[model samples]
Target: MEKNPAVAFNQPNHLPVCDWLNRAIDQGLNERTAPLARALMRVQEQLTWRYGYERMRPGLARKYAYAELLGSNGPVISENLILSVVLFAPKHIP
Candidate 1:
């Protein structure tokens, strides 16, 4: 398998949760959805950091990395929301 050029293994690809949230808000993200969006971003950052891009395979059918932030166990303290981040391999078809 060839390395994915989009994945930056040596550098951080995602911004910090607070920075992301602020940017989202500045970009016109609905105020009502800010909390949920923040939580989702946090989960995404955690997953990406946990599984570096180098560890992810690049293909259509290969296994992907995922992380689930459920209820009180995650950044969101709500029992109703479940935020999940699934990092799929970038499949470039040429």
Candidate 2:
């Protein structure tokens, strides 16, 4: 079986940040949403770099793990927007 690139490198599996954002905008998002999308991408990049695919503590209340990347207290403050990554178990059924 072929190994996943992100797993082999101990990195998160996500599209290249800037490229993804540009594509999203090109697809349908209005020009005004560009700034917000850029901010969201920055947050996503931060979380991906920080956690990658590390295991979470056992017996946690939530089946997934996540970190707030943007919000009132996050690195990127946003009054009207928030971005986070909810990491599910590998090959999760649901």
Candidate 3:
């Protein structure tokens, strides 16, 4: 089994993050466990919500983003690392 490619939404890529995750699910990338795929779906939603709010109000975005990063929505962890990086993300970044 091949390892899954890292999901990178900020970088210019062929597929948007949501599409990429859906495709992976459709391809049974997480066949070993349906939970994994579902977890990823949740991650996708969290990212979408976080980024969306981020554009409107960074303070508001931080609420959802921080929760998502802390895995308040699911069993996923490690988003804290991503949040850490986001904390220092450039103001000009989109």
TM-scores for every candidate against the unseen true structure = 0.29, 0.32, 0.29
15 Cα displacement, candidate 3 (Å): 7.2
User: What's the lDDT of the predicted structure labeled candidate 3?
Assistant: 0.37
Q: Per-residue lDDT for 12-54 in model 1, tens only?
A: 3342222333354444346776676566554444433234365
Residue 82 of model 1 has an lDDT of 55
- Candidate 2 on 1-94: residue-level lDDT in tens? 2232111112343432322333553443457766755665554544432333456454332334455555543444555566564444333323
Residue-wise C-alpha lDDT for candidate 3, range 1-94, written one tens digit per residue: 1143234333122212233345555554547757755765555544433343425453443232322333323223333333321222223424
lDDT of 2: 0.44
- In model 2, state the lDDT of residue 57: 50
lDDT, model 1: 0.41
TM-score of 1: 0.29
| Candidate models: Cα lDDT each | 0.41, 0.44, 0.37
lDDT of 1 at 70: 42
Worst 10 residues of 1 by lDDT: 1-10
